[model samples]
Structure formats: C-alpha cells, structure tokens
Target chain A: MTTDDWVAIWLTAKLATLTTVLLLGLGTPLAWWLARTDSFWSRCVGALVTMPLVLPPTVLGFYLLLLMGSQGPVGQFTTWLGLGLLPFTFTGLLIASVIYSLPFTVQPLQQAFRAIGARPLEVAATLRASPYDTFFSVVLPLARPGLITAAVMSFAHTVGEFGVVLMIGGNIPGQTRVISVLLYDRVEALEYTQAHYLAAGMLVFSFVVLLGLHLLNRERRV
Target chain B: MKNLTLLAMPLLMTLAPNVHAAEVQLAVAANFAVPMQKIVAAFEQSTGHKVLLSSGATGKFYAQISQGAPFEVLLAADDETPRRLVQDGQAVAASQFTYAQGRLALWSAKQGVVDNAGAVLKTASFKHLAIANPKVAPYGVAATEAMIAMGVYSSMLPKLVQGESIAQAYQFVSTGNAELGFVALSQVYEHGRMRSGSGWVVPAQLHTPIKQDAVLLVRGRDNPAASALLGYLKTDAARAVMASYGYVH
Candidate 1:
C-alpha cells in the first residue's frame, strides 16, 4: 500500500488503541466493583452496563447522535465548555466505539475479578496493606490473563466496528474513513478487488490479535 | 346429491388453477420507493397482480440480479445500469425506457443556508458537507459534479462526508450531523411544496442528465403483471405523479 493507504491503517490503529485503553480504564473499576458488591442496585448497574452488548450498534449510534446533537443536553453542556459538536468528528467516533466495545472488555474483566476470590484481598488487609495497594500488588497480578483478554477483545472489536461508526463518523476520507468503511465504499463503487483485500486483511488481523492473546494467557498459566 | 357436489368442487378448483394471482418480484432503487408503491397499488387495483417490492441501492440490485435473483423488473436509479442489463440480454431490448429523471438538491434544515444558485458551497463557513457515495448513487455523482463545477472539489474534499445512499445522505443533513447535504429532490418535496428547509436545485450544466430507467427482466418478459406495470409507468397519469415528486418527465 502507498502512504495514503497507510494513513487509514494508522488512524484505525490509533482509534482502536484509544478505544481499548478507555474501555479498560473505565471497565476495570466497574468490573471490580460489580464482582465485589452484593447490593441489588450494584447488580442492576452491572446489568445496565452489559446492555450495550445486545443492542444493535446502529441503534446505539442513532441514540448517541441525538445525545450528541447541538440541541441535546450533552451537546449543550459540551458547547458551554467550548467543545464543539460530537457527531461526524473523530472524537465522536472514539466515544461511540468505547461504548460499543465496552462489553468485550468489561465482561472478561468481571469474570477475572470474580475468579480471583476475595481471599487474597482479605489476607492483604490483615497484613495492613491498603485496598488500593492490595489491588495493584496482588489482585492485578492474578488477573493478568483476564486483563490481556479484555484488552485484545476490545481492540479487535473496535477494529471491526461498522454500523455505529458509519452512522456517527459519516465516512470522511483521511479522517473518519477506517478500513471497514473504506471496504464498504469500495464495494458500493464496484471496486470489489479493493474490498476483498481489506476484508481479508481485517479477518487476518482479528485472528492474529485473538490468537496471540490466548497464547500469552496459556503461557502465563503454565 | 352430496357426492355429486363434492366432485364439482375439485373440478372447479383444478379448472381455476391457471387464473390464480402470480407474483411479480421487483428489484427497485431506493429513491423510487414512494412512486413504485403508488404504481404497484394502482396496478394491483386494475389487474389483480401481486407485486413484491425489494428496494435497495441500484448497485446492490444489479449485484443480486447478476447472481440470478428471481426479480421480474428492475427500476434502476440510472439509465446506464438498465442499458447494461439490456446489453447482457438480462433485460428485453425494447422494454428499456426512461421512467423518470432524478434531480439533485443541496438541502439543509437550517433556514437560509442554501440558495437556488448554490452560493453556500462557495463560502468556507460550513464545517461539513454530506453526499451519498458517488460510486453508487446517481445523485452523488451529480453532487460531485456540482462541487467540481463550483471549483471547490479540491478545497472541500477533506470535509466531505459520504452516505451509502441518497436516503442516508438526506438523513445526515436533515438530522444536522452535517451543515448541508446533497440528496434527491424527492426526499424533501411534500404536498406540492418544498419541506421546511432551504434547498438549491442543482443546475443541469453541472452534471450529466440523471435519466432513470425501468426495464422488464428476462424472466418477466412474457409475465402479464410485469408487462402491465411497465405499461402503466409510461402513462400520462403516472408521469404526472412522478412530476409531483420532483421528477422530470
């Protein structure tokens, strides 16, 4: 591929990376809280967070557009803070993707947190370590595989995202035009050869990311 | 007496088998949705023929037809596709005719944003411009032509946002995702008046004529329902209906 083609690849990588990081940062605490909390309200909140997994991406993007419109509450608040409109912009795409891929990261992390068993934390507390210290020094080490899985899954999911990104990003070339949207445009223009190349690339990319993470997890266990 | 009446019921059923309503599977372009619905309703009312309308982008329909879909008629968004179908012998030669002419318009929900002379695109104040994917939608090509004619293609290329089709292009600007968008005139015209918004009717000098063609597929060449529908589209009444929707006869 030429420099122009690489630009799209680079932007896609950047967007996917940012989305995965954001999801992890937001998801890690929420997953831990959900895993530890026994309250009914916490469980309800957990369920609500997982809801995006089942909802169609297009549906999510549609509501997100309304929420991010200039007249909408979020838009008005952001405008007051000097942040412009959200939809049809790169930052808007990042926000949409973070929500769309939240479950992929959150679910695995939640399961990992649950598997760690409160025993480690309890022991650390008895030894006079703070809750944050126990989390960083003990719980995090044990849940390494789960964290890896979450990051990889989230990144891979964001890479393949289509409907939501298309709806919100508006397919601006060299800006919001990721590989999936580019592939779609190629097909629409009857450029099937280019579309095939991009589709094959995505399939291979997803497989590699998943396989590499799984392999690393297996190695860590052994 | 009961046995004789039972035998007559079966005889009547067998005799009327050929008179049952037949399905006319149609692959129509998305822009023609409303007009096709009216025409289908009128056709069914006059001839009792059942039609199953499948609306999508013309390129998608063409792909399906090439793959041997059981569509009887193709109401394509452009003449070139139908003409190609004729060349491929996938459609009848004489059956191809321009049903309506598509008109491209630059529309914005924001009042006074677009003038009929397309003075808005010359200004750099607009942040985003929306148009359908030029490779697929006919109106998209027209939009690009208008931009190129206005000498803004190079400058505005970065800010252009492409929708998959004309309907979605309209949605992008109508929902205010983009400041303005290029879309089909039919999308905004209602009840003999333009919808509450400003739109610039693209001049013919900017682009090639968008002569939309409707053709009977090879499978429907002899089908009664397909023939009837094609005939109806050529009528003055149908032309008038299309005109109301901003289609040129």
Candidate 2:
C-alpha cells in the first residue's frame, strides 16, 4: 500500500475509535434514562435519538451544512465562543459521526439495560445502597455485554461511514479523507490497482470484525 | 382494464415506425448541468424524444462507461475522457467533438471578498479555500495550475479543501462555509451579469483550455435518439443557451 493509503487507514481508525468512545460516554446515560423511565418525554427523546437510523445520511449532511454555516444559529454560537465554523474540520466530522452512529450505540445499550429488570435495583435498595453506587458496581458489570456491543457497533458504523463525510469532509488529505473516501477517490481516478487493494482490504477487515463479534456473542450465550 | 390499455398504448408507440421519438440515456458532467438542462429541454421539445439525464463528476462517468453502462451519450467535463473512450473502442472516434469551453473563477458569496485580480490567495487571510477534487474535475486542475502560476500554490495548499465536484465546491463558497472557492464561471455568471456573488475570472493563459467534449458511446450507435441529441447540441439555439451560462464556443 502507498503512504497515502496508510494515512487514510490510520485516519479512519482514529475517527472510529474517537467516535466510539464519545458515543459510549454520551449514549449510556441517555440509554439509561430511556430504559428506566416510563414517561411521554422519555419516549419523545427516544424517537429523536433514533431519527438518524431511518433518515438518509445526505439529509443529515445537508441540514448540518446549513446549521454550521456562518448564518446558522450553531455557527453564530460557535463563532461567539471563538471556535469558528465546523464544516471541513476534524471537530466537525466528529460531531457528524457521533450523531450518525448514535443509534448503533444507544439501541444495544438500551436493550441490555432493559433486560436487567428491576429485581437487581430492588435488592440494592434493600441494602441501602445509593443509586449511583449500584449503577457503577452492579448495573455496569452486568451490562458488560451490552456495553461491548454498543462500542463495537458504533465503531463499525463509523468506519463504514461515507455519504455524510463526502458531503462535509471536503476530501482533504490527512484531514477529512478517511478510508472510505480514499477508496472512492481511487475508483474515480481510475487507479484500479489501488482501488482493488483498498476494497479487498476492507472486505477482509469487515468480515473479521463481524466474525469476532459473532463468536464473542455466542460464547456469552453459552 | 381501461387503464391497462392506456399504459400499453405508450409501449405500442415504440413499435410504430412513424414515431421516431425514443429514449436516450445521457451521462452529463456536473459542471455542464445547467446548460445541458436547457439544451435537453429544447431538444426534447423539437424531437419529441425522452432524455433520461444522469449528472455527476466526469471521472465517475468514465469509470461507469468503462464498466459497460447503458448510457447512450456522455457529456464530459474534460476532453480527455471522451478521447480515452474513443481510444478504448467504447465510443465512436468520429462522434466526439468539443461542446463547451469552461472558464474558472475565484468566487465569494460575500461581495468584495474576492478582488478582480484575485489578490486574496497571496494574502492567506482565509481559513478555507474550496476547490473541486483535482483528481476528477478539470476545473480543479485549472485552479491548481493558476495557483501555481501565481506562485501561491505552496502557501495556499494548507488552506485548500477539495470538494467531490465543482458543484460542491460552489456550494461551499455559496453557503459561506469557505470564504472563497475556485469554480466554473458558469456557476457564478448568468446572461451578461454575475448571478449572486463576486467573482474574478482567472486569466486563460495560466492554464490550458477546459474543452468539454461529448461523445456517442458504442451502445448508442443503434439508438437514433442518442445521435440526434449529439447533432442537436451543435445547433445555434443550443449554442445560445451555453453562451448564456458563460461557456465559450
């Protein structure tokens, strides 16, 4: 592989890793609220969180460009805070990937939280344990499988991201040009050898990731 | 039963010899989209033919064409792609011709941001300067050549943001995401005036001419509507539409 291809690979890995970590941190509490609550507001928020799952990524990218443009409310706020606009930068891409992959993290984690039921909470309550302490000590450990799933799913989804990034990324080398974007560039430039190498690598890598996840899940079930 | 016959009537029309109107599948370059739309409208009106248009980067169209896409005609953003198709035996060598010559411009959404001389590039005041991907769009290659000719390419490289196509590069500038961008003059210019923004038309001497070529693909030889569209493009009426969009003869 060429150095540029390696750069794209490294960038994609970094973006996926950062997005996975951030989503896990943010999605856990939100997933918890959805799992524990039975209110109309919780349902409303849950629906909002899952919106990206159904909408096309181009729709998201289009609205995001408007929202982050100089005339946008977010843009005005960011400018006031001295951060400038957020279209072609790393921070902008991170914000986009996190939103795009939110459901991947929250859905799995939410299911795990719900599966835990109330019996464990009641047991901790009888022991006079605080809700915070019970969550860290009892709930988190029990939800390990869900946490792993959430992390893996989000990582994979972010790695596979293309459309939204294409819209906002500007395709700058060593900046917004991730592996998927690089692969697309290769194909367009008629560099078939480079394109084939990247495509084949992605095929193998994706299969390995899914196979590993499947085996891990099967082991847990057994 | 009545509606089924109504639908079948349209299908039967293709079998009738008197009706020459047939569908022509077209793959058009993104930069020439506006002019092509107007041309297609007139061509369809005159010939009663249905033109199914698919527009994107020329590089992508070349890839799809090589893979034996069912496109009857290709309107490319650069001359090279059509010539390559002819050399590869995918298109008729005699059917290829220059349809439009493109002009590059440094444009800004805000007034006065881009001076007529395009002095903004040397100062390095802008955070981002959008340009189409040099790997794909011919306008992108022109922009790079101009920047290099002006001796600002090295310093300007850090601020460059490569849009997937000229259209997207225009979007970045029009939306004020990038303070300025290099785009086709047709994007910012209309009939005898600037459309909405300020632009400096880059001098032609700095870069080679952007000769956009149209070709009838091998799959299009049997399709009368396909060749008809190519002939229609050379008409005075079609030339007028292209001229209005800042494309040269």
Q: Which candidate leads the pack in lDDT?
A: 2
Off by over 4 Å in 2: B1-18
Tens-digit per-residue lDDT, B123-224, candidate 2: 857899999999998989999999999999999898999998999999898888999999999888899567887889999898999999999999999999
Docking class of 1: medium
Give per-residue CA lDDT, model 1, range A6-56, as digits (tens).
767887999999999899899999999988888999979888888889898
How would you encode candidate 2's per-residue C-alpha lDDT over A1-222 as one tens digit per residue? 999999999999999999999999999999999999989999999999999999999999998988898888888889899999999988999999999999999999999999999999999999999999999998999899899989998999999999999988999878899999999999999999999998999899889888989899899999
Candidate 2 yields a Cα-based lDDT of 0.92
The TM-score, computed over Cα atoms with residue i paired to residue i, of candidate 1 is 0.91
lDDT of 1 by residue, B113-189 (tens): 88878888888878788898888888788889888988988988877888887777877787777789888888887
Clash pairs detected, candidate 2: none
Q: Indicate which candidate wins on DockQ.
A: 2
